[model samples]
Target: MLAAQRRDLLLARLRQDQRVVAKDVAAELDVSEDTIRRDLRDLAAAGLCQRVYGGALPASPAVADYPTRRGVGVASKQRVAAAAAALIQPGTTVVVDGGTTALAVIQVLPTTLAATVVTHSPTVAAALAQHPAVEVYLLGGRLFKHSVVTCGAAAVEAAQAVNADVFLLGVTGVHPDAGLTTGDADEAAMKRALARRSADTYVLASAEKIGAASRFTVLPITAVAGIVTDAPADDDTVRRLTEADIPIIHA
Candidate 1:
């Protein structure tokens, strides 16, 4: 019931759920929403959590490291991955960007599906390596340590050689005005090249990623042909994308 106790409890909940809503915490701790916000702010200042709109999220979710990213958002990524994987037809060359979402797509790839997958993420390459029916092409370049994806001039050049049917882009943020953005400059550059080389580009994002903006811009909304998310297509966000002329597919 004390401030320190409440803060500790809130952090425990955030660790377990990956995020915590202010209203829920307020009710549980018999405090006002403002008080919960103060606690969140204090926690964030202490480097204990990252505050989101209505709540706080764990400072580091999956993707902080390769091993940690493997299981984060497993169900949602699986659904998104399944849908993205289904888009690949026989004999198609596809480019999967470097993100946990794209890695999820690789994990659920059907044994019957056949295609050449181009990616810069070591995690994704490792996943696709187990698939005998798929041809995996690892792009070479300087490795981005946080995401464990290759980027730089070499990787960009390697992406230019292939004309892919689809580029499955993993977005850190998707806003109507900001379009698609990411947190890394090198990754953004690589994604831009992948989009240019592919005939069609699809963005895979979770609901939380919608309306968010990161530090680096990748592609604009018009550049993406479709967006696949875990939420239902009838959600307001899906309708917004539909109105904007971007096709929305529910995972």
Candidate 2:
């Protein structure tokens, strides 16, 4: 098959099976594995797919800019947000991560619920301004515009001082094999730092993020308390996550 044909078939397989194994596709196409690997490399460079150890996985749309992502997964984000927001109890402290899904969470939190929220995102902190009962703690640092979250040594240092009952984490991708991932190195580091400070961390995974892969891994799938997602329960990704014993909280 031609290289263009390979790209189309590879992407199709990624959509259907959630991943494309290089050898498997090579055998099916009667082509050499090197050729398939080259195709995967080109696709990855174009941002059309995320290359993994063996082959490729679907690229997450969540890697887009903050404003663009706001319109990408609206309903699914709301579902997962509501589910994650439900985990916070009154008088408890929670760390809310930065992302569109995390932003949606602010809309679901009860205005009367008294709680403390620690965050590295100025966006999240500003949204909580109207909440009369909740106290917001903003972690200061260099702003990472892509996700609109604070990062760098200052943010990681601030995270160490926090002790939260729960952390509503967000990532660009949630896969059984690829684990939890995001697009930026600093954002991933910031996420890991916050997870350490919180007793439990639950990922806010909307439908679009499921089965996708990003450039940098934030944490292993098992590191999280549970995955809160609106993706179909029977989805191959979801099924594999269940098989791996990662808690799946259906939104």
Candidate 3:
């Protein structure tokens, strides 16, 4: 096929699957892997995809701002949040990440339950103000506006001090091969630090994040205790994670 035709077809596959492997696309199009690579590079230059080592991911994931993210996949996030909330018990000290989904976890938490909540997001800390039994600790640091969370040395040091029972982690992507990832380096560092301080870490992932990848690696998928998501066990991404013996809680 012509270069333009092949590129269009590749874009369509990426739209449907959210990713396109170069070798797979080459075979499907009856073309060479070099041709597929060129097509992907062109697509990336056109701002349609983000080129990865062996594939390309939809560009939206690479630059999804906080507000846009808060509005996408609402129901899926709610289900994930519900499952994550159930993991928390009374008197548990939880390290809640700052994000819309994490906020949903705060909303679903029983008011009667007492817990210590540590976080770097001022917004998350404020949301817990109405919880009469919860103690809130807001980590001080340089604020990162994209996700509206704190980062840098102060945040990392503060996270080290908190002895949390569990960390309700959020991420931009989760892949069996790529592990847990986020869009920014500082946020990844802060998340890693928090995970180290917690006894157990559970990632709250929406279906969109499953099988996806991002620029910065937060932690290996095995580093986390488990994943709480709404994806079915039969799904390809979920199956891969399960095969790796990574526990998945389907909501």
By TM-score, the best candidate is: 2
Report the error of model 1 at residue 58, Å. Answer: 15
Q: What is the TM-score (0 to 1) of candidate 1?
A: 0.73
lDDT per residue (tens digit) for residues 1-251 in model 3: 88888888888887667678999888887888998998888988776776788989765353477888888889999999899999989889999998888988988888898889999888889989999999999999999999999999988988777899999999988877678888889999999999999999999898878877777889999999999999778777798889889999988
lDDT pick, better of 1 and 2: 2
In angstroms, how far off is 199's CA in candidate 1? 0.4
Local accuracy of candidate 2 as per-residue lDDT tens digits, 1-251: 77898899998999999899999999999999999999999998988899988898999988999989989979999999889889999999999999889989998899899999999889899999999999999999999988899999999998889999999999999988889999999999999999999999999999999999999999999998999999898999999999888999999
Q: Give the poorly placed runs of model 3, Cα more than 4 Å off.
A: 12-19, 27-32, 45-48, 57-63
How many pairs collide in each candidate, listed in order? Answer: 0, 0, 0
Report the error of model 2 at residue 158, Å. Answer: 0.9
Error of 3 at 184 (Å): 0.5
Scanning candidate 2 in windows of ten residues, the lowest lDDT window is 1-10
